[model samples]
Target: MTKRSRRTHSAGLKAKVALAALKGEKTLAELAQQYDVHPSQITAWKQQLVEHAADLFGGGK
Candidate 1:
């Protein structure tokens, strides 16, 4: 059997997912199911958001 390659999401998509998670509208598991991604991936995205939040305010696009 041939191994299937893993699919990768774009940076923008990851940012969107992280923003949704930060909004507190849903739990990490819920977000993960909604986005069809792993819970750990969502956690990592959220952590990155927390770490780089300052950059967002600094207008560093």
Candidate 2:
């Protein structure tokens, strides 16, 4: 089996995946398959989104 190269995801893509996870419209496994990302990564992004969501409202400071 060939090892896959590491991939870098853009902020926009990360945000998109994170938002989808937050929506609860799909299971993590389903999202992972659709996005070609690991469920743990999606969970991490979702956590970051939830943690920093206030930053969008200028509450980051």
Per-candidate local distance difference test: 0.91, 0.98
- Pick the TM-score winner: 2
- Expressed as tens digits, the lDDT of each residue in 1-61 for candidate 1 is 9996898999998999999988989999899899999989988988998999898799876
Residues 16-38 of candidate 2: C-alpha lDDT, one tens digit per residue? 99999999999999999999999
Pairs in clash, predicted candidate 1 = none
TM-score of each: 0.77, 0.93
Q: Alpha-carbon error at 27 in model 1, in Å?
A: 1.2
* Steric clashes per prediction: 0, 0
Alpha-carbon lDDT of model 1: 0.91
